[model samples]
Target: MAETKTPTPMFPVVQGGGSLIVAWQIKGKKVVVVGGGEVAAGRILNVLNADALVTVVCPALGLNPEVAYRVAQGQVTHVPRNFEPSDLDGADMVLVAVDDPAASSIIWNLCKERHIPANIADVPPECDFYFGSVHRDGPLQIMVSTNGKGPRLASTIRKFIAKQLPKDAGRAIESIGRLRIKLRQMAPDVEDGPKRMKWMIDVSDAYSWDDIGGLTDDDMDNLLKYYLSGDVPSLNVLKGLPDGKDASDIDLFDGSFGFSVGA
Candidate 1:
């Protein structure tokens, strides 16, 4: 018989070594952005969407058109001077976008001393978090990150994923969220947690995106009533629609879920 040997392991066995991704909530918090160039403009927009109070520390000459417009509109405060150590005061988060490496390093170190999270553009090692390419649709946001490598590639990947989703996916999510709230309010006191979860899963699995999107408030009430009675309602019972349907009826063929490369 020929000698047999075990193959070598192809990957590392370490666990919990990569970045811990999270949807951070920074509403009504202070975010200090250093520099007012194009890079800083992108950061400011992201923080603003999260409802963070932002202050940009940079010379007036450095402000890009977008950043200057924000300052003029009173959307964010512009100090119009070089960064100061006091800029970090009362900051919930910090982001550095200046072209000066030495100045960025100094700011990063200051954030470290204060235990504040920071992101230094183009300097992955100094960054506490890396920004990901994001796709936003109402309350839904999908992000793709390359762990500080090949940012453009990550963006390409995000677009690819978006192309596979249905155009009404976000609308479906909103409708389901409303139904979930109504279900919680109407659940009988005797329904246990597991029972409630099982019925929810069953209902979600039984419906398509278009079906869910087409549901009315009265339909939701009828569906929950059936579930509470130990019945997973069919499409016919809930909306008087055909019960046997598949994903082909969705809007996937329209190309990229209402998103385009230019978008």
Candidate 2:
């Protein structure tokens, strides 16, 4: 008999804190934020934008203008008192942003006992999750984190990455979705899931509209036509227009979109 040896794993396993990143759905969920300073205000805004029902547990005097405005509008519930362990009740997630480490630790332990996810600002060991610099483009979002370390650096890197993306990235994404639907309708015979996925991947990697100056309505029509009846549109169809217009002038590729990212 020949000796058999187990093969090593392809990727090294990392063991440490804050190594996993995930997008959590907090919509319509109850989130408790325990602080009233600027950091807490930022977290509150993020939760509010996610449509989470938020409760802020802090003294009435310390709230920043943005948080106070939301409270006045009834967008968020204001506890108007210092955080207590009881504040964590009914919370799906908790963010401890208070300045007092003792109070934050108490809240973190309580949340752990109750099995609720908790994040304690500036304290990695006490946090169940860490807030990251986030960039949003319609349905697409990118989050960058430094494992509970150096948030400023993470934010700087995020801004640089954001600048490299096309301004109409979201619209481009929608156009790609429409193309996927058309491709599927045209290739109904490809039934296997893996085969269909591979076909989509190949088409996406091989297809390019750069030679045509970018994606345009005419280009989309031509693409559909090619897929359906093998007719290719003229490459010069969108070449000449008054005042230097080109395919990039098309709304689908126009660089006129903007997105907000939060730290």
Candidate 3:
């Protein structure tokens, strides 16, 4: 009989880098999570919130009754079993939250082999990616990450950071995003980062536009064109646009940019 040697644990692996991030609609799609612990429940909750059809596969779950009730209620599907390689088939997304490293490693290998993206809890060595600790208020979601270095520390800081966010922060970020797009279309030549940031600040802070109240959508179009093209005919131009009239119209309160994600 031949003796087997243990392989090396590949720690501190770089999972993802410098990639463009955006939210996607996942309603009625398949998302599989493996585990019965609080961590697994958390991942499932997030997936459910995103409107994805979620499936949980675990032999035993130490979760709340509500979650199990959801399974029984047919809102979410639960499979009472340990994982197998065949579980990877047709799985849009996979989450491995099991405590067994060997089982997690197998699931990760299956996902890799099948070209499915997988997130493994506390098992970065076998993870394709990770979900950040999230802080969401209405339209604002702040995500913080440490690139998988110190997850607990990163999450703790994010919690503290979230405590400091104002109620209208999400709306403000959305407003800025819309304004930036308008500027790009209206003033393609002068559309740079600094100018866009300046325009956002000006519109959100020192100046306010309140003339687009009764204006047609076409008028709003022209308004954005003018601002981005350096044709600031009037400070009142914003009023002639849509959804541009209120303290809640913009969410520039939070200084967080590119810091809204996973640790």
lDDT of each: 0.85, 0.74, 0.68
The digit string of per-residue lDDT tens for model 3 on 112-147 reads: 888888988887666666677788865567777666
Q: Report backbone clashes per prediction.
A: 0, 0, 14
lDDT of 1: 0.85
Candidate order (TM-score): 1, 2, 3
lDDT (Cα, 0-100) at 181 in candidate 3: 70
Cα misplacement distance, residue 243 of candidate 2 (Å): 30
Worst 10 residues of 2 by lDDT: 254-263
Residues 1-263, model 1: lDDT tens digits:
98999888899767764687899999999999999999999999999999999999999999999999999999998898999999999999999999999999999999999999999999999999999999887778998988899899999999999899888888888888988788777775554667778877887788998888888877776676665565775675455422342222322232446553221
Candidate 2 local distance difference test against the native: 0.74
* Residue 226, candidate 2: alpha-carbon lDDT: 42
Q: Summarize candidate 2's per-residue lDDT along 136-195 as a digit string, tens digits.
A: 886567899998889999999999999988676666666667666666766767554555
Question: By lDDT, highest first, what's the ranking?
Answer: 1, 2, 3
Q: What lDDT score goes with residue 22 in model 2?
A: 82
Q: Which of the predicted structures, 1 or 3, would earn the higher TM-score when compared with the native? A: 1
